[model samples]
Target: MTKRSFDQFFKNPRHWREDLVAVGGDFSVDRLLYAYTHGIFPWSEDPIRWYCLDPRAIFDIHRVHFSKTVLRKVRQKKFRISFNEAFPIVMQACSYREKDNTWITPGFIDGYLELHKKGWAHSVEVWNAENVLVGGVYGVAIGKFFAGESMFSFESDAGKIGLFHLFAKLKESNFELFDTQQLNHVTWQLGAYEIPKLSYLDRLERAIKDMVPWVIPLSHD
Candidate 1:
């Protein structure tokens, strides 16, 4: 499929009125990278709609919050954390929500798996005492910017544990942007807040140009 630039589809000023931006594109690795670096992302996959939200949501790497209960779980070492250990499994887990429909289609998985193999995507995995997977989060990274895509937990507080570690990794690596895409209850608890789209795009432009490596430690608990 031929790829088109963001300006091509976002010419209508009305497109800025809502978060939808543009619809119908392939989920190729290059397309994904281009979209994300430009403050755009694919939230759905049937026809593959791309979005750059008006009020973009993000977490300040240095200002993440952990509830007292989550802090206790962290202090107790309730789960083992690993980086890039099980990217496919983590994505699959995030896609399986019994109570709601998911936007993560098979094509989306394939596209991101390719990105993982190319070192542009990464995952933080949580494992129980027996080493079975319990929770995880996955996202794409470009330069100093990281776009967190989704997370899932099978055990209480497990997903939060994964997010805590992910934030730590980003902070440690001097990442400048941590885009959660949109705010939800979980993200709100983690200290995510919104910035106007123009502000977000400005930050994104600088972030994607500053060279930074994803040198997170292999594992943590």
Candidate 2:
């Protein structure tokens, strides 16, 4: 992929038309990191028409909705949660969910795996009482921001439980924002709200400067 200026290539995500900075390039580790750091993420319907998205809406860390219904399910704790235990498998499963549009192609998977190995990507995994992997969430974490990419569940409420735990852990770790790329029904129900690009960028700028310890280390191969 050709090198693009992240600042120039990125603007708050818009859906009325294609709002992309650059397209048609390789998925290199460097490109991916720069994109996420600057609030840009890739999306393509056909795998060939890749576009970077930095949506206008974001999940305010303090405003995340935990509905009584969802909270009740979360409290039931039908599953156990772990971190980084099965990152690859969790990511692959998240890539292919029935009837969902996927940007997590093989190349994207390889790119994120590289990010994981570098400690820039991480997973929150949920397992059943039988010790079977059931649900999980994954995203890119840089500074105090954890940009939620996707999630999946093999059983009822597994993903929701995983999300609840993920938020709990993020709070403990002092993360500033939980960025969900665009406004959707799922996040709407979860309490994410849309903010204008100007405000989002301001918060994003401050978020990138928080020097809290990353949830994982970047030392190994």
Off by over 4 Å in 1: 1-18, 211-213, 218-221
TM-score of each: 0.91, 0.83
lDDT per residue as tens, model 1, 1-221: 23456458543323466777678867777777767776888888888887878888999999999999999998898788888999999999999988897998798899999989888999999999999999999999889999999999999989889998888888777789999988999899889999988888889888889644366654443
- The residue pairs that clash in candidate 1, if any, are none
lDDT against the true structure, per candidate, is 0.85, 0.73
Candidate 2 residue-wise lDDT at 171: 76
For candidate 2, which ten residues in a row score worst on lDDT? 212-221
Candidate 2 lDDT tens digits, 41-113: 7775344343434446677676688778768977776677888889899989898757775778788788788
Clashes of each: 0, 1
Give stretches of model 2 more than 4 Å off. 1-18, 45-55, 210-213, 216-221
Per-residue error (Å), model 2, residue 188: 0.3
